[model samples]
Target: MNTKKQTGIHTGLPKLLLIALSLLTFTVIMTACANTKSAFPDSEGKIKITATIGMITDVVKQVGGDHVSVVGLMKAGVDPHLYKASQGDISKLDHADIIFYNGLHLEGKMVEILEQMAKKKPVAAVSANIDHSLLRAGDEKMGTEYDPHIWFDVRNWMKATEAIRDVLIEHDPDHAEDYKNNAEAYLKQLEQLHQEITEKIASIPESSRVLVTAHDAFGYFGDAYGIKVMGLQGISTASEAGTKDVTSLRDFLVESKVKAVFIESSVPRKAIDAVIQGAKEKGHELKIGGELFSDAMGEDGTTEGTYIGMVRHNVDTIVHALK
Candidate 1:
């Protein structure tokens, strides 16, 4: 036997030792790669940002521009009030350099998870800086907390935009100028949007400004745009609309002779349909004005997906139906 150890790859270490050394080297490389990828500007040279909802994601995308990669956990027509964080969402949150959410209990189910994550990273509520006075008091059924739908009013959204801009600047100062410029441009666009919606809403008669919907997500919109909003469900969709609630809203619709009630994209249509049936029984003809984007925006690529487009679509829908 040519057992002269056939001058092969010779290592003094045992097989087990060789294996351990291989694993160690692999782990070190992996750790180095992970550390490099986790840097503020990721491997793609963009900050990794995660947002709880599409609205916040839109704002971040508008402001972060090319310097950030955003992941929105909530899709169109997903209700934030009832949304729970998934394992994938947790992973995204863990990997994100920063996270943005509407806050003020909008994301009811995920609040605890988000709170816990806040201790470890920059988790910010885009609506955090809004003056408390501007917020509508949440209905008692919805815990009587501050309403989290601050994005309804353009002014409030401006505040949210500012908060987002500030956070982006704080976390990634290298792109501070980009964020500032983008925010300023977006603010101007929002100002224009506000004026446009105001003028369009002005076309609707004051008496017809009643905006009945599936839920009370539009309280801020109503308050800002001079409409009377009523919903079978409370501010949070997590609250069910009882029979009594349906009956009461039906009576209100009949009494006020409100011509149209709206359905929300995120809320189930059953409740609104019940109200419609109840109204029909009372001899009031109520139409489903249109589906409004509440607690969510429209599809991603459509114009309605954008904040400006969503607001405009809502204003136009309200005016077209009620006016």
Candidate 2:
């Protein structure tokens, strides 16, 4: 997770023994070698690339550095689930040197367009989906598919970063080294983030490792950590939380005596509150834990506004609430 300091965009670094020291030295020396900008326009001075959303856009900026000018189609606070491409989006994609989307059918309605664009351009799904074995199937209530919210877990996102870097290197051979170095640097940071998150989550009591949400988006997070996840909605926001599912969840909350249920930043708390309400009906009272950054990051200009910041915020909130 490449943590953003403030303004949701400020972006990280580190090493082994001698190899690590040399890499750090090299990074300090090469700090001024590239720019994280767009990668189009043919003119060495200007390049234009488009990203599907803010998350992918930030990632491109982190890895592409100043070598490319990037455009993000989805505005902050916009739901990617039902986003429709405007004329401007097509134009941006048409002229982009490369494009990145959070695949695994995340952009469900937009997949056809993206595939067509991929035929004539370099495009990637950029999810841990490529590694099918690691993915768990979404429950029948959430539709018959695997959950696409792999980025919810920082460790899973590192795989997507590698995929992004590999594709960028292939398309823009000139900046292969730069892309590789940036991705490597970011990957190390993500590793550290994973450890940090693990330690934080570990600080919570083992009996408190229960994460309930509006949807099943936290499957990967729960999988990575030792938490039992219960969701009122399906894996996708498109699916509504059904009566049976809610009843089952209510039963689980009462049986497990779960302490907290979390609400996603992008989702309404009404649904989660219902779960808590049901628990109270059964003589079990559950806390709201805290608001978490789930499908999307926090409000723009905040620490949790960036991808890394969002994850760190989640880790901190979860640890604090559960512990």
Clashes of each: 0, 14
Report how far off residue 253 is in candidate 2 (Å).
1.2
Report the number of the highest-lDDT candidate: 1
TM-score, candidate number 2: 0.81
Candidate 2 global lDDT:
0.76
> Top TM-score: which candidate number?
1
- lDDT string for model 2 (1-323, tens) is 43545534432232235678888889965642332313233436534668876777777777877677777787656667667898767767876767789877767778888989989978876783357888878556534477778886776788888888887787778989999999989889889888888888888888988888887778988888777787787777787776787789889889887888898866777778888888898999899889887767766677776788888888888888888
Position 318, candidate 2: lDDT: 84
For all predicted structures, in order, the TM-scores are 0.89, 0.81
lDDT, model 1, position 298: 94
Candidate 1 lDDT, 56-169, residue by residue in tens: 999999999998988889999999988988877887787788989987888888888888989999999998889998888886666657888898899999999999999999
